[model samples]
Target chain A: MEMYWLLGLPLAGGITLAFWGHRAHAPEINAAFSLATLIAAGWLTAHIVAEGPVLIGGDGWFYIDAFNVFLVALTAFVAFTTALFSRPYMRIEQAHGRVNAARLRLYHASYQLFIGTMLLALTTNNMGILWVAMEAATLTTVLLVSLYRTPAALEAAWKYFILCGVGIALALFGTILLYFAAEQVLGAGGGALSWTHLNAVKTRLEPVVLQLAFVFLLVGYGTKVGLVPLHSWLPDAHGEGPTPISAVLSGLLLNVALYAVMRSKVLVDGALGGASLAGALMMGFGLLSVLVAALLIRRQTDVKRMFAYSSIEHMGLITFAFGMGGMVASFAALLHMTVHSLTKSAIFYAVGHATQKAGTQVMEDIRGLIKTNPTIGWGLILGTIAILGVPPFGVFASEFLIITTTMHQHPWATPVLLTALGVAFAAMFGRVQPMVFGETTLPRLPHQPALLPVFVHLALVLMLGLFIPGYLAHWYRQAACLLGG
Target chain B: MSLTYHLQVVNLLAALLLLIAFAMLSQRRIVGLITLFAWQGAALATSTAIVAWSTGQHHLYYSAALTLGLKVVLVPWYFFRLIRQLDVDREVEPMINIPTTMLIGIILVIFAFNLALPISQMAGTVTRSTLGIALASVLLAFLMMITRSKAIPQVIGFLAMENGLFFAATSATYGMPLVVELGVALDVLVAVFVLGIFFFHIRETFDSMDLKHMERLREK
Candidate 1:
């Protein structure tokens, strides 16, 4: 089945790379595995389009709907491109003596395993399995985040482990509460935890218990989504890890966490019978994250850390859009999720090469990117422009939809959202322009940088900005309907 | 009468579990904390087994065995070995003193009981009353994590929190499906191993297990 290949290849690749990832060709092998995963994801996407949503495996363990199927494809595509970018990036890290053979092996193995766990989390129908997958993803990435074994890296990993560990423990308690409510209706069995069955009988579930569960689930997964107050671990993790890991953490992992939150939102909304309690909570957190992260971006000296804050801000906008909960808002949230992941990862790719060329992570130390290498500089500038919601880009289109929807639905919040957007735009452009355009002091790298994936992602964003294909638009409408206000 | 007797025993164990959680909150020595964590795990396993026997939810028996094997025996053994190897078995000074931590733990327990009252009423399981104690222990563990500055005790705090969650699952829903329980158990075991590896790395890097040395990554 297409589902098997889609899930099994990364798992298989993880195992193979764990054993032989120290070889010189390991980066190529890693890319090959990711490409195969993308192909499998492509095949699975086609199958879903042809046959519609499906429940695969024994007892219908893997649920693939229009909601998650597109995310699965996007996850696979971004992961593959990240692997392409990392090939050269990791090689450069090795050339600099930043990582040796064993660490490289660890990075490659954990990379595949991380992708597998995210895919598993996205597909699993069981809430408990989803929790396990999310925890496993955390474990795999903690090691990768600390791959360099520097003091900062270890501290970041430790903070990531403890904070997320505690947060996820709360989520498990929430899951137990959900099961407690469900078993009263469905009886003691596996069906009590299956999302499909729960959704079918959601109306009959206890509203009080569902409300409590959603709070815990949101705070728990929201910690991973880099929502503020719970977001301290995120920027450090991004700032300290290898650039490729930062790319996926920003572009893919945060999206997966947001997807988990949205899934829980749907169930809670159904149980509450048109009450907007969950939506109100999401809106509060989302707006707070945007306002806080936009301001925090100005204080960042590390480029990756600054961009990580931007990710929090963008995720906030998407979460806010979803919280508004209507056809147009949900569609905009989905589009924002797509564009943000593409644009952010592309930006990280450019940042990665820029740091390598300048041999420092501090924004002030890196200068004259345009003079040193035009391709990397242009890539960084363009990606930043796209991400800042400049016109004729996918991010702009999505942000436009989100802002317009907010204005119509919740006029009181519109001015505040615009203020945050303006602050974030000024902060980002002010910091990035000097880094990209000003100086010629940096040296060129020995090897050719991989700018292809950067351009590839940017081109896709441009196309989506200009025109969204009919099938994709239809898909978004179906998914938005499934995620009803 | 037999059913009531079983319930009484479970309640007594739940009380003992709460006592150990409070003790862990006040314990200053890392060794004492790990020992208390193991005791908490023992109480949890005994209570889970009792629930399984009384309710005949056979899958809960496997969960009980897992708690015993992983929490009581294997993880504690690993912690003992790890502390011995890392030379970090010293007295840990909490950021807040002991009496204050205990006071906060008490308040948390009261809050947890209040929160659990309505939810426990809705739970049909015979052991549902223990849900309050379960939640209280989780909060106590979280409090312990926040107050401790050392790396190892904080990890113990995390493991204790997991024990509390397991207690909640068994008390509320008679344990999850066998498959889910197995997956959760495997994840906990792997987490312990991974954290153990990090202990050596952290010690090697910082030259001490105190987390204060890790304040290098903060914003200016």
Candidate 2:
């Protein structure tokens, strides 16, 4: 019963928003539903931490685990915040009349469905079901992306759909290969498709077949992770979609994709004597992505696109942490995941407000924010600092951990990571600080900023920076150990 | 003997599907592209039917029937309607020309064959070799997608890629489950309908179906 509400609250909000969204520009509805979800997520998070993983069954095929509980809570939290953020941002949109009730309905519904699909992807014990859930996520996001009905939005949606659809079809092929490999070990039938079942009998799985499946799964899901070469959809999706959608794309969607890649990473590591090849691949792509995104960030004029690239950079860094294959690095990866989610979401929320305040996403168009709206200006200033890995922020802690881990092993790569970080830092602070603090007289704005969600995430990020909870530190330590790096 | 007979027919059909995919890639005429896509779908339906017959899977026959009806008949009909309604231009200016596309198609075939080598060897089926051709066709269709300038041609390219995927499934594993096949068929239908709507949307925005115009929309 409780399991249903874990998925239902956002969905119900979506339905209600869709039905009466026109006459009723109800930020209250958005607030109410989202807050309810956050509370549910908080409850679930505490429950899971206290009680181990709470298993909700989709008949016998599905069950949640500890890993999924964290993701579900994260998704719900980020979503609820984005919704709270959306209340103000979308009303400005509503005022702009760029979107009508129908479009709002689409956005609301697709947002909930996307979050639900992501949670479903993370939780379900069945691997095939996981693939389908991810596919559902891809499809739902397509509609949300095209909601603005601009030509650019339409094209972005089409590109996103085609590329991701093709990529997911490849993932399905990979899943089929995994099933065959597992069937050879576990015998044919549903048993072949269950992750828990496969993990139990992982030793019997053939190394060569699993290796091949790993390639397919990586290339397939890596596209979603916005790994270089397969990352074209991401910038466009983030650039043209509504800002809340951008927040979700950066904050939640990318994490889900990385989580997918990590799942396969875990499976192959257990099967193939450990994740040497996968680790090497992850490192190669991760570093390359960091280098490329770091360079690319220097040239971006669109504020949204710049942050979109930052997302790629951070995800790259996180992937590199995972690739290093040490307990510390893995812990860093976990922390980076946490800090990055909080920080990036907060940054996007600020960027969205900045865009609204300035009447454009172009950086040059938006100036003197500090002179105009100090709340959002400070938000951007803090976010830019937090994202760039300034001291006493959670991002800094995680990034330092990642760097320290790199220093212990791959000393050669440390300079490159540092260089990339320096470049990214300069490029980001270069554009953003000016917009936040310098000059004067930007346009006056009527939009309300949701003070709570932004502050909540920032406070969390700050707290992590200031103090590490022993319980979470222990949990992550254990998880990293279990991950064997 | 029945198995061999079915195998040879499926193999021949798979080869034809690849050829059609290649032709669609190189073809300039919008009408011709749509025709080739229809032909590819017919081949897919035929091969699916052959697999069904040899395997004695009753559901596979339903898959073939659905493919035939949806891809070969209904989709082609819809394209014709789009052509008539849009009534714009005949010649499509591809991003790359015929010679280069065919060259790329050949290279993609080599890559596909290399990719399929191990997987095909593992499969204990007569149509296993066809997997390479199916993959090649899929790649070739993707190449078509990258090359084409017109919205209609890209859509055609997309449908042909789906044909390649379907053929790959049938060749590599006899076919996906009935539910999956039905889902894909429905997806195609919905996709085409959506694309039809998008075509009008694009036309209303730009006054042309040429994707080259869309290059202007790309971020500076």
Best by TM-score: 1
Cα lDDT, all candidates:
0.92, 0.80
* Residue lDDT tens for model 2, A299-358: 899999899899999999988888887789988888888888888889888888888777
lDDT of 1 at A288: 96
* Residue pairs with backbone overlap in model 2: none
DockQ of 2: 0.29
Sliding window of 10 residues with minimal summed lDDT for model 2 chain B: B211-220
**Residue pairs of candidate 1 with colliding backbone atoms:** A368-A439
> Per-residue error at B58 for model 2, in Å?
5.1
Give one digit per residue, the lDDT tens place, for model 1 in B1-220.
5999999999999999999999988888889988999999999999999999998988889999999999999999999999999987775665557787888889999999999999999888899899999999999999989988898889899999999999988888888888888888888998999999998999999899999999998877
| Chain A TM-score compared with the true chain A, each model in order | 0.99, 0.96
What TM-score does prediction 2 earn? Answer: 0.92
Segments of candidate 1 deviating more than 4 angstroms: B91-96
Candidate 2 yields a Cα-based lDDT of 0.80
